[model samples]
Target: MLILKKLSMAMYMDQEDINIKFEKMGKIRTALVGYGSVGEKMHAPLITVCPDLELVAVVERRQEKSKEKYPEVSIFRSLEALLEADAADLIVIVTPNEFHFSQAKMALEAGKHVVVDKPVTIHSREAKELKQIAEEKGLVLSVFQNRRWDGDIRTIQKILAEGLLGRVVHFESHFDRFRPGLADNWREQDVPGNGITYDLGTHLIDQAVMLFGRPDWVYAEIFKQRTGAVADDFFDITLMFGSIKARLTASVLSKAPMPKFLVLGEKGSYIKYGLDVQEKAFKAGELPEGANWGLEDAQAWGELHLEHTSMTYETERGDYRIFYKNIADAISQKHTLRVPIDQAITVLEIIEAAFLSHQEGKRIPFKK
Candidate 1:
């Protein structure tokens, strides 16, 4: 372990080495809805950084909380008022899951591009309806599956792309936390889309589908593990894609350190610990600027194990800005949506299947 750790202590690469030239076709007036933790911390900062996106407005019902950080943005009491004022060309819904469908539907009908936080909607049917509306109205629609930009995930993608793992047969991912006490947040309440399944499950399942396409079947055991928690806090979902099996797990009561990702193949395997660093930076209220943005420490890189040897693998720089950048480009017709609404709907369906599987104690088959 000492030798590997010492060998892994290579210099971090220059940020410019991975940076891309952002092309802006046209500036999009973006409005952020729900100035909650995700909206203020993640969505707003990402929107303000993209060269082709302009942060023009925010929607907060009780207070103008967004104004403290983004004073230039117009504050409205509701999505309806924001629409009435015609304040933005793009609508980003970061409200709770229940509001995603209605708000996204309203924005699409208003002829505005829409971006919703993950899960897209509480139900897959609602997501499908939103997709149809976006198609019919000629609007850009995407979900905030921003974890696709996570450094660890980027590393995994590169490893698979290079065939370093050679015909991977098994994959496992964990998003664990140690929050024994429940909070007053909506996620902890007995509300629609109020569980780890809808939260982290959306990200894990989206990443799975993004890499392996829709699974052939799903088996899961999802339940609330906390003592006083009314919402679910633990989930172990298995997504089966023919020869490959992907296992995803998340829990709020977990304390023991677990591998963030573990993969096995015929030739080798990869084991990575620690989560991405971008969220920490964002929560610290750092802007997604400068050359060294999204780069992780060298000591935190994943490890690759072959038949005879093993070494640390450099992680790809994570950039959540890519999401909004693609959104802007799609709106400009310069590029396609990376997190398309269709894929998000599939994730919802998978989540639905997982819940059903948990209830029935059987693997749920996918619709062909």
Candidate 2:
């Protein structure tokens, strides 16, 4: 057992050596379980160019359709088959909400690194179990909370770092959209982790927790705004950290949406509109890199309101590639991951508390 462990550790070369080896290797072996919207649009294309990662085989039930879409890459029908084939070093789960835990558990148990699309799991307990499993198995477990790398969010983080908004007292985040007529996908179904709070809310919540540490108390109200929707369509979340407060909201039925971000402090306030364009560009098959990748349209620039005067600040460019780059660095070089496991666990805890608070009609205290 010790010899096998040493061999695995040895295979994980230093970051620089890994980069050199990757250049020589040409591709890092990888597989996608679900070829749905996220997998086909985001992960697959990004992996195609990532120097340290490669697309080997995909796991799908329909062999013919998987082959039709990706003729060069082999297709396995199940996780068991994929594991036995020695096809990949890493497995990415973009499956339905309820399947994330099981799929990730299977991957880690099989001695392969794993990555799951956001919300980590339906409940905090599930996330905790997965964390324990990953630790015991000595594997890399990561969540695809891509919004952390959003260009505008990064810019806001930089502003905060620079103390532009002196002594932040209140902040707001919105992810409004026009999806009233719910899609036919599983996201719209009534299931564990199938609401806006779990869907888009995860991004806002994760960003809030990322910017500010875990809150002492979380006050949230979730409801369905769409006429006939089974799951929630709107959420108003407030995270309290002593005297400061972070407000987050998202609704699918809004027509005239407001700024994506609003931050206020003793010195000044900053307001930003328009989502990042990287996803749109990514979907359109464009990866020029270091160009205008994350640039916000000038007309949609944010406004900065000083207590004494008002000024408009052009939104900084946004980038999503950094997430993958950092993951590769952590895996190959043993560097600290951009978003550590503890933070992911915190996000889940907040989510669990929010659900409990909503059910009992009161603010829930976060346990240390």
Candidate 3:
């Protein structure tokens, strides 16, 4: 009798401990809606690394690409199937720009919190509608403006905050690439929201807005530089904020080395070369966690040219993991969203204005 009583008590205590562990875990089951390069390289790894988030399922329409990397994760052949199964509490839409709106809408209607990639939707009105739906459902709706966490951008932010670059006069950001031949992909195709403006322009514009809120006017020039290209491969956009002028440009044919960021202020100037190291590391299959992760080399630091002197400024650490962690926190009501939907709407508005400016050959004043 004594032995039996001891065994029963042990079992009860073990079960209690298990319950505590489960409660403490408190991980939100996350579902990734696409299996493309950004999804595979950046989103999946970041989601897996977050302790508060679990990558539970994936939406791969044709192939089971996610299974090999995430064996335990269930793979659904379609978003509809995943929704029917109610597999996830959080849905991350990393599909093409065209599908972002419909996919995000479906996820929200299914009562799931959503995280859409940059340019939340191709149109500002659609983004506002998503925001309204999420608000009505009391759910979190966020856009992935991940470049706001870039090392070079963070360094620029710090410089501006500290007044190191007193009274910033001009800001130039470039996402130039050397791809003379067009790749066979949806981005290069002639589709709505298929261009450098929607692809790279979103990031550049978002970063600029983060730094200097909204601009007074937007003037842009967009073109198709590469032969046989149906979509725009080049863009030079200028955002006028009173006296401060921000030039955001990207090109597919530029072979010359241009600074990734060049900011001119009354006191000094900052010029940074090379993209964030984290992106290259991510493409190389490196996870987000490590002692040396997200650190830019000393040689790659931006140079601050001041009156009678110039010195290299240490680049800030870039961590995209913060974006996912914030998402998890926002879902749990522990924190407010870092990348809000309204900001994304403003970005789309600016993108629209840029297109209008390009077509009309005139600068367009911001309405709001």
Highest lDDT: give the candidate number.
3
TM-score of every candidate relative to the true structure: 0.92, 0.91, 0.93
Flag the better candidate by lDDT, 2 or 3: 3
lDDT per residue (tens digit) for residues 242-333 in model 1: 89999999988878999999999998999999999999999999999998899999999999999899999898999998989888877766
Q: Residue pairs in steric clash, candidate 1?
A: none
Better of 2 and 3 by TM-score: 3
**Model 3: colliding residue pairs:** none
For residue 113, model 2's alpha carbon misses the true position, in angstroms, by 0.7
Model 3 gets an lDDT of 0.92
Clashing residue pair totals per candidate (backbone < 3 A): 0, 3, 0
Rank by lDDT, descending?
3, 1, 2
Worst 10 residues of 2 by lDDT: 61-70
- Cα lDDT of model 3 by residue, 1-368, tens digit: 99999999766676457556546768988999999999999999999999889999999989999999999999998889999999898999999889999999999999999999888999999999999999999899999989999999999999999999799999999999899998989899978789899999999999999998899999999999888999999999999987999999999998999999999999989999999999899999999998778999999999999998999999999989899999987776668999999889999999999999999999999947
lDDT of all predictions, in order shown? 0.90, 0.82, 0.92
Q: Which residue window of length 10 is worst by lDDT in model 1?
A: 16-25
Q: What ranking of all candidate models by TM-score puts the best one first?
A: 3, 1, 2
**Candidate 3 vs. truth: CA RMSD?**
7.1
Best by TM-score: 3
